[model samples]
Target: MTSPLSVIILAAGKGTRMQSAKPKVLQTLAGKSLLAHVLDTCNQLTVDETIIVHGFGGDQVKSEITNQYTQSSFTWVAQTEQLGTGHAVKVTLSDLPKSGKSLILYGDVPLVSCQTLAALKAANTDGMSMLTLTVDNPFGLGRIKRDQNGNIEAIVEQKDASADEQNIREINSGIYCVDNALLHKYLPELSNNNAQQEYYLTDIVKMAVADGITIVAIEPEHTFEIEGVNNRQQLASLERTWQRKVVADLQEAGVQFADPTRVDIRGSLSAGQDVFIDVNVVFEGDCTLGDNVYIEAGCVIKNAQIGNACYIKPYCVIDRADIGAGVDIGPFAHLRPDTVLSDNSKVGNFVEIKKSTIGQGSKVNHLSYIGDATVGTGVNVGAGVITCNYDGVNKSQTIIGDNAFIGSNASLVAPVTIGDTATIAAGSVITKDVDSSALAFGRARQVQKNDFQRPTKK
Candidate 1:
């Protein structure tokens, strides 16, 4: 029978360098909290259960994490005094079954992948295994002290190491895979006789060494994958690292980007063939761009589904809108929820479409507002047009039939409609419907009075 695997994540530290009241693990990296990334990878390891150790800002971290993943069955272990890493793990071990393997991780180091963890698990023995990395400069990190034959050795802290021990390039990465029973049996015996008076989990290797237990060390391919964050600089560095990875993934999946570094995708994006996304674009909450779509710079799209051959010009704010193929939306267009544009539609600059449907081959050009309106095919709605679909109390609808020509500066007050092939004169206020193939002129006639002149005072 295969032994079950459980992951223990140490995330209780309050990062003072971060300069925030939030816990260290709660700091966002790559649009997700550090602990969230750790737990996501842990799930891929087939981990039966996840146990988190919380200390500083324990209540805030617990409350936020619990709220974020309400359905997850994770155990919380509280070490009230920030005793140390060893004591943190000890607080959570009482809940474990004491038979399977326990993999220890740090939440601030959020980039660990499932492949690396699987490799470490495959290399684990009956004793204990440590994830080790060799660097050019092993300055402040703890050194891995090996034996004469180099079979097995102990992990020595930086402060406790002698001058000779400090020269070792191989450093322990603070991650381990160990048998649960052996780990629990030896963890309680760890002492705090050091200068800091804190229990170090690294000392467990020495205890295992004294008992003639074999220890294996595995190095991760990328050293940055294990770099833990204690400050803002490290957090920013890792943020760039993760963002590059995201960009690479999307590019590989055939998404064309004008500038890879300038795009930010906070949620899932589905792009069809020949979709062009310009710089400074942000897409969130499951956006889909169909084939031959062109999206300009400074666009923020959320929860939208755009169809093929559409042109979304610069600085457009789109959310919860569904668009059909061959649509053109503007340099400054705002598409609010439930707005649907059918094929061959044109919504030009400074136009706002909300809760409306624009039919095929319809054009609503510059400086127009269409709300709660249904516009038909082959319709031309000119500049400075307003639907006037609101009476300051409730919104109403204005429906237009096919081939209608609405002139410039026209105000179509709802609830009203214009029949097929109807024409409205420019600068008209249309309050009533016009019959098919007719003209409707609602503007009063302009009359110039010759005697209408201002008199000068005597």
Candidate 2:
């Protein structure tokens, strides 16, 4: 049977190096706070309880978690004094139970895999487990020591380590899985006699060793999985590292990127077979693209869906829009919230669509604003057309039936309807309904004054 599990995330550090007023864990990567990412990973484990130890900017940290991640449940413990990592966990002792295991994680180290964590938890069958890493340069990190028989010994921090200990390549990753009871037993024994004059969490290893408790050390599969962020430079570096992994996975899945380094996915993005994304394209929020979809350069798509065989041209911004299969969207189109384009439709350059549905095979070619409208199949909307959907006080709708042809520079005023096969003249402002196969013209009569003269500048 699996052991009951709890999580304690350490996020109390002030991160003086980051030079930001907000807490360090609140720093975002791929549009999610670092703490939020850790919480997301912990939620996958379905642990019995999750506790966060926050100190500096504690209230803002709690607020960020509460406002953004509504699904996550955590007991917040404020570390009143910024003592150390050991003290951070010490403050949460009351919230943890006596029997179940507790997994210690870092908020700034956000990319640790669920598989590695599960394995670490499983490794703690009887005693404590420590997550270690083997890096070429372990200069600033804590070093892991072992005895002659290869049994686990203890961890030595950089300042506390001797010259020989500092040469060891294997360093502590600062993540641990310990029995809750053992943690409670050993936490109070931690002393603040180190170089930094703070209670180091690594000291617990020596206490466990002296007490004859088994210490299990496990190394993560990848070095980047254990990387932490402290400053702006490191944050940007990790961001690229994460993007590289994301793009590589997509490449393995047969999605081709024009330049993998240039693409940014702030939230979730999934593409089907043969989907091709061009340079400088950003996919934010939840977006899915179907098979044979082609996204051109400089496009930003947020909370949208692009259907199969669709072609999206350069520099378009689509937000909260649903585009259907075999559709064509622009070099400079702006699709706002509540916009839907049916199969084979075209929303061309310089067109802005909002709260409207363009039906199957319909075409709104260029320089148009279609908002709060529903347009039928096979309708042709020419350049410089406007739906005139909004007034100062209220907004209304414009409806166009199948096979209707709206001329260039036409303004279809709100609450108007054009029936099937109707024709609207260029530059007309139609305010009433036009029947099927009928012609409508709402422009002023053509009258030329013989003696018209330009006014002189005053």
Candidate 3:
């Protein structure tokens, strides 16, 4: 049987270079914290236990992670000192089991793919395995040294390396999969006699070599997968890199974009075939677009489902709404939570609908606010119309039946109903219910003022 896997994520570094009050692992990338991404990757693997070593902002990190991943089990170990990488892993040794393999991961390196990790784990059949990368400029990184016969040797850090060792291009990625027994054996013997005078995790390579244990090396599919964030500049660079990969994957699945670089997806966005998305469109928190859906520029859609052939004009903000087929929404419309639009419904510019249902073939065109209302089929809500649903202490509903006509500048007060084929006159304020096939006018009658003289200016 394959051995069980335990993951130890080192997040103890106090990132002074980042210049933020939050911990280094808590820095965000692509709308998620860096440590959150690492935890997400660990979820992809069949890990028996997850151990996180936190130093600075440990309480905040633990709280956030526990809240976010309530179902997953975690072992939080406190590393009170800012020690080297070896010391970080040393703190987690007591929590690990004795029989399985331990995979060491870094919280700041958020994008390491699960496939690469699985490969490294598979390579740890008898001894240890690590992930390495070949770069053109290997300065300030740990160089992977080899013997004359090309056998695996020790990893030399930049400060402790000779001129020839410093010239080596292959660098250690700091991700390792080591046997749990071997980790307990070698970690205790690590010495801090090097230039930095800290326990170097890379020194384990030399210990394993002396014991004649084979060390396997593997590389990731992309260079960005192992990139670690140190400052805001690196964080932004990796953000763009991650977004490009997301867009590339979406493009492969036949989604069209006017300009892929301009769009930002903060969460998962699933699009069907022939879907066209314009520039500056931001999708957040689980959005889906049906086939042939056209989204114009400068729209923010969050937690919404749009049906097929829907045309969404520019600058619309849709949140927690469901739009039916062939619906057209505005250049400046706001569809708040619990709003639903049926098939062929039209919502024009500057309209705001909250917790309302617009029936099929209904049109609410221009400067309207419909809240806590049910608008029936074939109904026409004219310009500048609003439903007075809230009255300081309570909220009420407005029901408009089939073929109802609400004229311009009309206000339907709470708990009111406009029956089928009913007509509400312009500029009227209807407080009571209107019967079916009836016309209601609640405005005051205009009287001539010819006899009254205009007031003189004081």
Q: Which stretches of candidate 3 lie over 4 Å from their true place?
A: 451-458
lDDT of 3 by residue, 1-458 (tens): 87999999999888999999999999888778999989988899999999999999999999999999999989999999876999999988888788799999999999999999999999987679999999999999999998987767999999999999999999999999999998899888888998998999998989999999889999999999889999899999999999999999899989999999999988788988999999999998889999999999999999999999999999999999999999999989999999999999999999999999999999999999999999999999999999999999999999999999999999999899999999999999999999999999999999887789888999
**Model 2, range 1-458, lDDT digits (tens) per residue?**
76789999999988899999999999999978998888888877869999999989999999988988787678999999978889999999999998889999999999898988998998886679988988889999999998998777889989989999999999899999999998889898889998999989888888888988888888888777789999999999999998998899899988999999999998888889999999999988999999999999999999999999999999999999999999999989999999999999999999999999999999999999999999999999999999998788899999999999999999998989999999999999999999999999999899999888989999
Clashes (N, CA, C under 3 Å) per candidate = 0, 0, 0
Worst 10 residues of 2 by lDDT: 65-74
Among these predictions, the greatest lDDT belongs to 3
User: What digit string (tens of lDDT, one per residue) describes model 1 on residues 254-311?
Assistant: 8789999898876668888888889999887788989899999999999999999999
> TM-score, each model?
0.83, 0.96, 0.94
Q: Rank by TM-score, highest first.
A: 2, 3, 1
Candidate 1, pairs of clashing residues: none
User: Pairs clashing in candidate 3?
Assistant: none
Best by TM-score: 2
Q: Is candidate 2 or candidate 3 better by TM-score?
A: 2
Q: Whole-model lDDT, candidate 2?
A: 0.92
* Candidate 2 segments exceeding 4 Å error: 451-458
